[model samples]
Target: MPPTVHDRPRDDRGYPVPAITPWEDGRPQFALTDYQRSADCARQRQCSVCDVLMPRGPVWRVVGAAESAAIGAALAAGRPYRNLAPTLEGPGHRACMLYASMVCPYLARPNARRALTAEHPDELTAAVVRGAVRGALGAVVGFADYEFAVTGSRVLFRFVDVIEYLPHDNADAHLAELRAELAGHGGGPARPVG
Candidate 1:
C-alpha cells in the first residue's frame, strides 16, 4: 500500500507525482540534482541524481520509480541513487522517475492516461520539453539526471548522473523554444537554462 499522502494527478502512465514535501517559499521546493562523479576529486564519490544504493537496493532502470513508501526511509538512512540508463537503454520506453519529478505536471496527475495518447505519453512529453528547455538553458549542465520525492507540498529533485552521462558542452538557441514548451505546463515562466 502507498503512504497516506495527499491526492495528486497522475501522468499518462497512471503513475502519480505528488507535490514536494516541507513546502519551501510557498512552492514545492525540488532538491535539484547534484552528481558527485568528479574523477578529479579524491574520495570515491558517486552521483546522487541517478544511482540507487539501498540496503538491498534494486538495480536502477531508466524511468524506474522509487517505491513511494520507501523514499523517506531511504533518504533518512542516506543512500546514493544512480541513473540506470546504460543497463535499461536497450529498447522500449526511455523514462526515469528521477527525470519525471522535475518537469512533468502530468506525472503527478492521478490519471495520466486520461490526459495522454498513444504517441504523446507522459515521459515523451517530459523529455521533449525538458530536453529542449534544459538542453538549451544548460541547467541540464549539472545533472546526468535526478530523482523526485514529495511530501505535502515540497518536491525533492535528487540529481543522479555519473558514469552513464556527461555534461553538455554549450548552450543553444533552440533552448528558447524548449523553455517555451515547459512554460505551457509547469506553471512557470519560460526561460533558457542559462
Candidate 2:
C-alpha cells in the first residue's frame, strides 16, 4: 500500500503520486516513493517522498555513507554538484524527509561495507551536475557546486547513478521490511521486491 493523502494535497486523482524517472527511451518510471527530479521546470521545491510541492523553504536531504564517499570522489575528480539531484538525496519538506529516513529501505539498512563488497560492488558512480535554487518562483537554475552537510546518520548526496538491486546476505529481509513499511503506511500493494 502507498501513503494515503487523507489530509494532504495530491495530484488531480487524489492518489499518492510517486516521483518519476525519465528513461532513455523517454518512458517514465514511477518509484514507489518520491525520488528527486531536476528542478529545471520550477519543480525543485517538490518533496520527493510525498509527491507534493514543499509548502516552505530550507530543503532537507538524507545521504548514506556509500554516497558520501562517492560524492567526495566525484568532487575530487572535478565534477561539480550543478543542481543535479543527488541519487541519494533530493529536495523535500521537513516531514517528508523524516518519513523517508525512517521507512525507505535504501536508507533504513545499515551501510554496505565498501571494502567487503569490492569483489562485486552493487553501487554505480556517475558524473552529474547539481542545480542551484534561484528567485521566488522556486526555480532552480545554474549548474554550480552546492554545499552539503552530514548530520548523524543522514548525509547529503546530489548526483546521478542508479541503484539496481544490490546483492547482500540480508537483501531479501530488507526488501520485506520495506514492503511492510509501505503497507503499514497505507500505500497500495507492495511490489514483490525492492
Compared with the true structure, what per-residue lDDT tens digits does model 1 show for residues 1-194?
A: 11211133344454443332113344432222111221111022222222212121111222222222233233346553343322201110011222432344332322222222223334423343322222111112223333444334222334353212111213132244334433544223212221
Kindly list the per-residue Cα lDDT of model 2 for residues 1-194, writing each as its tens digit.
Answer: 33432344334444433343333333333332122343321244455555566543244444554444444455557654333543434555433443444444444345422211122222322221122111111111111123344434233444322211122222233344345445565233322212
- For candidate 1, the 10 contiguous residues with the lowest summed lDDT are 86-95
Output the number of the TM-score-best candidate: 2
Q: Where does candidate 2 stray beyond 4 Å?
A: 1-17, 21-44, 66-88, 111-194
Cα-based TM-score, every candidate: 0.20, 0.35
Clashes of 1: 33
Residue 83 shift from truth in candidate 2, angstroms: 10
Tell me the number of clashing residue pairs for each predicted model.
Answer: 33, 18
